[model samples]
Target: MSGSRPAATATAAAPARPGGGMRPGGPGGPFGGMAGPPQKPLNFGPSAKRLVGRLAPERLGVMLVVVLTVVSVALNAIGPRLLGHGTDLIFQGIIGRQLPEGVTRDQAVENLRADGQNTFADMITGMSVMPGQGIDFGALQSVLLGVLALYVGASLFMWLQAYLLNDIVQRTVFRLRSDVEDKIHRLPLKYFDVNARGDVLSRVTNDIDNVSQSLQQTLSQLLNSLLTVVGVLAMMLWISPLLALIALATIPLSLIITTLVAKRSQQQFVAQWAHTGALNGQIEEAYTGHALVKVFGRQREVEQSFGAKNDELFQASFGAQFVSGLIMPAMFFLGNLNYVAIAVVGGLRVASGTMTLGEVQAFVQYTRQFTQPLTQVASMANVLQSGVASAERVFELLDEPEQVPDSTDPATLDRQPRGRVEFEHVSFSYDPDQPLIEDLSLVAEPGRTVAIVGPTGAGKTTLVNLIMRFYELQGGRITIDGRDIAELSRDELRSNIGMVLQDTWLFGGTIRENLAYGDPTASEAQIRAAAEATYVDRFVHSLPGGYDTVIDEEGDNISAGEKQLLTIARAFLADPAILILDEATSSVDTRTEVLVQHAMAALRSDRTSFVIAHRLSTIRDADLILVMRDGAIVEQGSHTELLERRGAYFDLYNSQFALPAVEE
Candidate 1:
């Protein structure tokens, strides 16, 4: 139960692996068997950018959102500048009240815009200048109204832009989730063996959440900050090029610090995600094994395991958040230093009579404005990085190669199948070096029963997997009625075959609903007939609601024997031309076994059938018995003929029947 996983191999033809260290399985084999792989340190970069590219199709909406964000930030930055203008106007009014300064009101307004200098500079420099103009109440009221209007407009635009930004992000995430689901279904079964289900779930749930949070909250803010920073810098230069040059010195330093911090934080966040997935998987495993834990009285041990995983998650999360949290404070500290520099330099200029008091005031206001955006951007760095990490995980899933692709020119199923099966020199293996079936061949004529008996791992299950086309044959081919299974449409081939697995899966629903799943077109009468054939009718009628009795999740509410009988009834409803019973009666008791045997007898009447069984008693009456060992047939004959040979089949049968069962 370690969090580490097997090293995933890269396929040049397949999609790229998500960022991580690679440590393939050791010399033993690639599958890793019981032991998991070594932990790989996760990275976040190229994969994240791939997600951005995936969102490119919606670029227009994203661009529109960016534009609105810039407008919002620009308006916000202009506020202080507008205030500076108002202050100059008030100061000019006071100067006008003094001895004539040779300035008209229009010229004063124009001068404030052009030079940000007022005639009052001489008075402040030891020349007793008198007031020029009295306070104009009407003008002051108009200025107040203008300020209110500008603030209101900016607020409205900020709200609108933020709304659009969130909308665009939500739409993109919705599509991303759907695409991931589709890709997961397309992935081969082999992929699942190497990857953790909990990890995949985390990517879809928590990672997607990160992306959404960045979009809704941080995305617009980041853009606004950038625009503010740039605009403020421009105005600062206009006010005092010397001070602006001094303030600009901090920009590169801040950028370098932010970049390094963001990169480190991103890597930590990726680890956090990995641990989160591990934690989720541990919880699922603990809960699933709760019965075993309680039976063994190991509740404390379970608790300890969970605590350890939770602590790992906590440590990783704290580090990531801590580093990300430093960015804002650092940015603000630099901003404050720049502010002090501007204030001191501007004061010197005013003292030397080189700059007017109004000009100095304007420069200080612009300098503060410029630093504001940098602070905002720095604060949102965590959200942006977290989103990028989540995006990478999601995109990786979507990029997995499809294991089963449609044929280049699929053949149409134009007629009903005759149910002839032939396995020609077919060989396969879960592990490439260990062939499960080696150049083995067999044929099942229409309406015949072909029973396959073998010890565990003799490739009995693997053989069935091929017939169902679950795994492609490594060599040779399987044909149905002279048509190669590969050439035939998967749907066409599978539609003709009905399967009853050893471990029957039952969805949460009424018995009738479960039966209907096999053939939705079946009538109630037909359903009852199928049930009766499988001896399921006896159990159904015993229930208070008969077919209406609800089966709990996984059919845990019912007995195993009853569940198997219901599955058989389901196959009957499908009325497939071919049937595969894989250990179909292994779980039933003696009495139930007899009833199930009757059902099997009826089922075998007019269809091609393949039976894989551990018990020799079930196949004693089979049309043909094939004994397989180590991927090849060791014996093939009728039950008596094989037993007479006293070979592998005889030894297998004698070993089982040799033991006498005690009465319950």
Candidate 2:
């Protein structure tokens, strides 16, 4: 996704919508909020071929599958031809078979009758045809046994093909999903500001699913169609060249029609997938923000928006299917026309003794067989195009630039962290035109609590973000422990700091697991001690399951204060050299806030702490205070110094802390 916040330019530069955004046919913008690394047109020429080739080296199973497919189709086709030959021989017997050069008509008739009877006898009583009208029942039984053997070969080959097809499709999908997942983890935090979670989720789930379905359905049809067309066409030529030529005449027309349908379907299918993604994103957004929707009484607005997207999906899907579905009936109609032409042309040739009835029968069957594969080829083209669309999306994500490169030249710090930080002439901006911290300079020594107080949008969080190197500064540098932060590995820099965010997020797992996330190696005793220190022990012990209790979907079962305390206990266990508390007590009651404040004070001993707060009481004991306005530091000094100056900090402290209360 784009590693920057969504700008108005993003909305304006987006492609035009189908019917002006009412249909899926509009510009490819279903994943509206989610940005991917920039996208390009879906190219399946050299790149697709190369990708398919790469897969080939690992496709041992596909090789075996192809072999089985060839064998099965060959056996199946030849078996029917042999059966038809036997039927022809029997019919010839019913008419007195024509004589050869040396044989009289009566003698030829006797010979044909004998061969026909021998073949039928073999089919029924198990005997082989002996020269000169002698037949053996034992040989006929052996022929029946041989039929079973042929069928066994076909069944075994079919099973092998099915197993391999499933394996290739599943393994390829697994690899693609793995790559998408890894990219998501590596993208910068700013990507989240532009994209919604639901939109990203749609790509990983719905888009990938479409690719898998296409692979599964199209691959099999591709093999069957190519082989069947070639095999049937060759057989037709062998049986009756004139009739085969007549049947072949229809191919160019059929191809033109198929090609047009595929092209139209491809465009519509792409729109269909785009609309599906947008609809999914809308549904996810509504579900995630159901409380907001209810509070604003905007349920009708949400429904209307969702309905529009859903309608686009329906229209695109219908258009694609309706156009593509034309291939079947058209093919069948053309095939029937060819059949009539072949019958009329070949029948006259047979009357003139140029071609036999058996050859004509075989030619007709071959024509039908050829058209069957062509029909399959046409039907499968739509699925192939859909897979191409999905592959484009998948590759788009893979090619995105990483936010933080894995440092190749990492700087090592001293054995112990001294907790000194310096921001030198640090000027930064989300946009270059609006500087958040223009030529700002600051320093914090070891074991000092620095408080940053500001009005909303005053760049307080931006300051902390820079210290953590979440975004590189535009015109300055930050030094941690006297070393440039950019030189330190991300892991090393992050490991030295702990943060408690305004929103406490917990995964769906046991309380013990969530607490242990801070320090996986911490002992049970240490965990309990941290909990007690943060006053989490009070509520945790009250629960029947205690630490064993499972948290559901961001800890909905626990009150906000309890969740904050749990997070605080978690950070306390980490014991970082620097701690960041961002509005950590904003959701708690007055009593809970006091308890949390006491716990935070104990945890702050001997650590470099940065507290972002609007509450004047929280920062009363801070060693230094920085009051900010509109992305710049307006005032800074010790609490007494700032109060004496009677500036922005002084006004903020009085407004927030001057209220009367019962004496504690």
Off by over 4 Å in 2: 1-57, 97-151, 655-664
Every candidate's lDDT: 0.73, 0.72
Clash tally, candidates in order:
9, 8
Error of 2 at 27 (Å): 18
Worst 10 residues of 1 by lDDT: 1-10
lDDT of 1 by residue, 1-664 (tens): 0001111211112111211111121111211111221244345557656656766867888788777767766666666666666665666566557534566545444554456455334334422223365556676677667777777888888888777777777887888778877787777655664565556677778888887776677767767777777877777777678988988899899899898898778777777777787766566555644676788887887788678777877887898899989988898899889888878887777656576666778778777777777778877777777777677667767777667775877665436666888888786766664446666677788888878897765667667779988778888999888888888777778788899988788899999999988899999999998988888898898998889999988577789899988888898899998899999888888888887787788778878888999988888878878777666666777888888999989889988987776999
Q: What C-alpha lDDT, on a 0 to 100 scale, does residue 398 get in candidate 2? A: 71
Stretches off by above 4 angstroms in model 1 are: 1-43, 92-132, 296-301, 350-368, 541-554, 660-664
Q: Which ten residues in a row have the lowest lDDT in candidate 2?
A: 1-10
